[model samples]
Structure formats: structure tokens, C-alpha cells
Target: MSKIDSAERARALDLVPVSRETAERLDVIVALLEKWQRTINLVAPATLPQLWTRHVADSLQLVPLAGQVTRWVDLGSGGGFPGLVVAAALAEIPAADVTLVESDSRKAAFLREAARVAELPVTVVPARIEQVAAQLAPGVEVVSARALAPLSRLIELAHPFLAKGAVGLFLKGQDVDNELTESAKSWRISSRIAPSLTDRSGRILIVTSAVPLAPIKEAAGNAKGSTHD
Candidate 1:
């Protein structure tokens, strides 16, 4: 097994302290991710060295934002960022669970195995975000996506859950201002931007509501015409 940076793990725990059991589960997830990377491009290869601070800590920061919400749906849960991470923390909470949606079959397989190994309450769905949006949106309390899409399209993809009162917590980069501006053209977003605990350039968008300004068909057409993220 490749040795993880102890200092980095400590730094991440300081940022978002978790129970020992949860921390252990997260460790297992990290190991699983590292193993899977050999065969699948789970995350950016360059980011592996700083995985604890960059990905794990970044994902851990989202846990407190949901504030006891147990039912979560992680859209585009590539490599199980906040999804599995959230599930790790919520393991102690009664009835807490996270549904991870990943379209790539290989990645989905990794998620299932990781969740199993970590003993987290997670359901891995091997399907596209659009295909299962409505089915999964019904009772989800929180919706999350990291590095998935632009704010405009993300809102579109997460609309069903948001409209039904699920709070959306999306991790974004420095271009957030531009993305927010672009999103405003299509959606009336009720949100607040929170500074990231890990990266200075990162921002966490907490969206309480998002009502589309365009007609449904128009929005669908626009989504189809735009480049996929």
C-alpha cells in the first residue's frame, strides 16, 4: 500500500474534524481511490499527492453545511468526493445515507466497492444524472456536485431536487463569479457563496432555490445546444 501523508491527513482533520471511525472510513476510501486510479482515471492524476487536503478536506467541509440532513444525492459523484466523504461522516447518524450517481460504469463499480469496504450507507447508481434525476429527487435533503458542470447547467440538472426543496451545495473554482453571472441569465438563484476551507481560490455555492427564467422546452434546447461539461 502506498503511504499517505500523515501531516496532510492531520491538516484535513483540523479543517473538518470527524470521529475516529469516520476518519478510518475516509482512509479506506483514499486507499481504494488510489488503487482504482491505476486502471481508471478517477481524479486528476496530478492532484493525487495532495489528495487529503485538496479532495478529502474539500469534501469534508460540505458536511456541516447540510446541518443534520441525512438524505443526500451526489450528482456526478466521480471518485466519490463529497458523496462518500459525506456518508463517512453521517455513518453515526441514524438513517443517514447518500446516493451516488455516476454515469461511467467503471467509476460506478469503484464507488460500490469503496462504499462496501468503508461500510458506508451509500447507494451507487450507474446512470447518467438526467436519467435518474426525478426518481432520486423526491426525498433528498441535500444535492451536491463537484467539478461537474457550470452553474447554469448544474442548476438545470439539479432543478428537480432544488424545486422540491433540496439545498444544493456545489463546489466551484475562481471562475465562480463568471459562472454565477452566466447562471443568472437562465435561473433566478437563491444562493450564498462560502469561502473554501482548503483552497483560497475555491468557493462553495449554497443554493436554497433556483427557478428557471426560460421555458422548459427552451431550457432543454439550450442545454442540448451547449457543449457538455
Candidate 2:
């Protein structure tokens, strides 16, 4: 990316004041992403060239909605995306901790290294979303995911957090409407779509309601008994 375009991208992201420190960290993030991309395929190859607008800025969009969140859980955290981006931003703010969850060990390693180099207080949890759900603190105030799962499944994975009254924010693409409709089939929830700050074609799903799906073991057992009866 050209120096001119980098400056423009920073301005568009509203990284006010643009401290030398902040600018340096942003550069490091891009460098790490470029290095890791060779092996893990973290982000879309086409999007790598525009990592500023496509990833960093896109992730920072959540910073505005984070109002007073002391702790946050990011699910399916591939290559750190919003999770690490938010962690870096939060360090500038007061009293915020970020946790990144990823099932892939390689991606988790990337998140761990990124968080360490950035000196951001981020916890990397290398586990599947469902397995890690029970360990999340009930007091967490926000949960986020990007391109992780359909809306309904996202809700299911986040049920523990929502049950404790935490809000859910998901980054979705053009199919958001279809995902919302499909989500409604299995869960009753309230949500809204906000225009993405980075991509006009993208939308953020702000969710406030979440209900657990019946356990698979229980649901299957019930089906079998009904059939026998």
C-alpha cells in the first residue's frame, strides 16, 4: 500500500490524533497478518492488499458500539480480525479486557502473538465456541463474531452470554437478511442492522435477545421415545 493510501485509510477509520505509537502498532498488525497469511489462509487473499480498509477499519467499527464494555468475548477469532483490533483500541480506552476464541490452533497462535506484540491485554482461548461457552464469565457485557456461523447458530453458541444479559454484535455480509430470516425459524430474538462503517455492502447485526436450543442429546432421545410410543 502507498504511504498516501495508508494515511487516507487511517483518517477514514477515525483514529484521531494518529499518535506515532498507534501508527506503528497498526503497521505491525499488517506485517504479522501478511506473514501468517502464507500458511494459515486467515483472510481472503484479495482483501489482504486492502488490510487497512478491509480488516483494521472494518474491525474498529465495533469500537463505537462498545460503550462501557469492561470485558468482551470474540468467537471464531480467525487471525484476530476485530478481536485484536478492538483489544488494541481498548488499551487506549479505560478498563476493557478482550478474549479471542478460535478452534484452529494455528489461528490461535497468531492471535496470541499479535496480542503479545501489541501489548494488548487479550486472552486467547483455543477452543471450539461451544466448548468454551461454559467458561465465559457471566458478567461479560458483549459478544462478537464475524463470518463465523449463521445468525441462529451464533445465537446458540452465545446463549450463555445472552442469558446473562450481554449484547451480541455480529459482522455480516449481504446475506444478513437471509440469515436473520433463518435465525427466526429456531430462535426468538430482537436485533437491528446498522450500515457498516467499512463496507456499504456489509451490515452489523446488533442482537439483544438469545435463547438456547434444546440439547442435541435430549432432542434426539425425545425423538426416539416418540417414535417408539
lDDT of each: 0.86, 0.74
Q: Which residue runs does candidate 1 get wrong by more than 4 Å?
A: 1-4, 218-229
How accurate locally is residue 81 in candidate 2, as Cα lDDT from 0 to 100? 73
Clash pairs for candidate 1: none
Scored by TM-score, the top model is 1
TM-scores for every predicted model: 0.93, 0.85
lDDT of 2 by residue, 1-229 (tens): 4222455566545743344665567667777877877877778776666777777777778877767777998888787777887787777657778998887778889888888887887999987777667679477888888777667667777788888888998888888999888877778778888888878799999988866445522111100000000
Q: For candidate 1, lDDT tens digit of each residue in 118-218?
A: 99999998887777888899889999988887788889889999989999999999889899999899899999999999999999999999998977442
Task: Please state every model's RMSD to the true fold in angstroms.
Answer: 3.2, 7.5
